[model samples]
Target: MLEAVGLSARESAVYQALLTRPGADAARIAGDCGLAEAEVGAVLLRLVQDGLVVQSGRPTRYEATAPDVALGKLIGRQEQRLSAARLEMQRLTQMFRDAGAPGDAGQVEVVSGASAVSARVNRVYEAAHRQVRAFDRPPYMQRLGENLPLQQRRQREGVAFRTIYSRDALALPGRFQQDIELSCASGEQARVRPSLPTKLIMADESMAVVPMAMGEAFAETAYVIRSSALLAALSALFEHEWSRGVPLVAGPRRSSEQLDQPDEKTRALLGLLAGGLTDEAIARALGWSARTTQRRIAALHKELGVSTRFQAGAAARDRGWL
Candidate 1:
């Protein structure tokens, strides 16, 4: 444990020996700690520098400081060094900010690695005041583990939070449904679209983060965009998609009877339909033939007492089916 306070193995052993034999010299400490006299001399010097041992008298007697007092002083010194480093970091950051052109459109930052990207994301939400708009999908580097609490806390702080998810995002592994549901329950407005290109997280309309590449290269790299026309354009795109997204937990699932009538498959189909998925896309998702999917859609419409697909959607919504 003394090693944690900057003592080497020999130094800690020597200190322990000194505690047991307070006025022990190097020869005596070496005997007790199983070290050679030369080794004991070097270890004692280091322990003295670390404030764990004190030397006194002409014979250079070594004494151990009380553990509590010595460790406390060591911790205080370590904390002071840490504080100084933090101040230096802040100073360097400010200098960099001052050196940069204000509001530079070309001020795009490339963030690489999963952990780095995740940290940048957490920072964005931590500082968000007005609102957070996000486009969520798969190829995720990290789960929304840290985001859950921050969203809930921000919601309580009255910072508007909304997330738009792709239908496929819900199907990806790793507690996707539970994560989204928990956020929605915590007052985050969540919606689902059938598809979304890339991923985006925009906070307060001033900054945004988006993948530098899309589709197959989604998780490879991302960009942090500052206040610029590109940021505005991304925000506009989010709003456009938000206007088209279906609330993941909007209104209700279905009337009690209507809910009991549909199995998981039917419910999933309804959700995809409500998300505005094309039949071809739905067929691809469900691994059904086009004809089979059409039949199912017709049957679904018939079950809802609706004639056209649009009416089916309306009737479904009216019955709390979507």
Candidate 2:
């Protein structure tokens, strides 16, 4: 554990010994840590230089600094260095792509197998800084809601997420309420479309991951696209689909008394209606029975003064309800 923060095995052992027996001389530390006196003295000098230990008195007693303060600072510095390294890596990747030969295959890497594809997907999301744009559909590589916590953390860190879900994806049993709606409630900007050409995820306009196929083995192969014209085209494709998508908003839940009024659930109903979901799909998402769902639709139609469901959807949009 200490090794991750830049301490070697010997250094960690010496530090632990010092921490347990503060104000000990190098000889005592050596005996406690099972190291030679000379080695302990050298380690003590390095520790003092690193601010992990303080040496004082003629005989040179070494005292360990508070681990919370010292280790926390060390970990912070390591994180800064890692951040810098990531930036440099991006710079080098760009340079490499720019210098690629005519038919070089460096920009697009083929990641094989389900586990590899899933791991690459996670890495792409983890590395995103500014924004994440995705076209979400069925045949998921990982379990549903697996990335929810990570996405929420990124949102809290000010990273923006925009996802366009296919209508079929939203219509999956329990998917809308359990995953999509919950994500929208947690700061994800969501939209739904009747269908999507493909599933894709792009991070900060720098990288994208697209499955090679959408069959039963869709997760077995994927193309990890680095910075290139293809990546730019994929980003443009996302924008096009995003423009055509209907906004899917999940509002705060209201009391049953508020059901008579136009509320979030109503807006969600309008969105689902616009997305072309059937009555059953809508009912499942809103946790309502078929009868209740029809009653609500009837009431919505009456309120909107529209005889047809399509007209109701259009009217709601006209009135800015969806």
Identify the leading candidate in terms of TM-score.
2
What lDDT score is found at residue 86 in candidate 2?
A: 100
lDDT of 1 by residue, 1-322 (tens): 7666666677778888889999989999898877799988998998888888999998999899998998899888878888999999979855653433226765689988767777777766755668989998876776555568877777887888888989776654433444755675567787888789769997786667798887666566789887788888888899999998886643234457664556655765676677666787667656677998899998998899888778877887786666
Q: lDDT per model, in order?
A: 0.76, 0.84
The parts of candidate 1 lying over 4 Å away from their true place are 49-51, 86-103, 106-132, 139-161, 182-188, 211-214, 218-225, 250-322
TM agreement with the true structure for every prediction:
0.61, 0.66
On residues 1-322, what C-alpha lDDT tens digit does candidate 2 reach at each position? 8999999999899999988898899899898888899998888888888999998999779899999999999999999999999999979855653432223333898999989988888767766778899999997767778899988988997889999999888877777777888888888998889999999988886778899998888889999887788888998999999999988867556577655446777877887888888899889877889999999999989989999988987887787567
lDDT: worst 10-residue window of model 1:
93-102
Task: State the displacement of the C-alpha of residue 241, model 1, in Å, after optimal TM-score superposition.
Answer: 2.5
Specify the highest-lDDT model's number: 2
lDDT over C-alpha atoms for residue 143 of model 2:
71
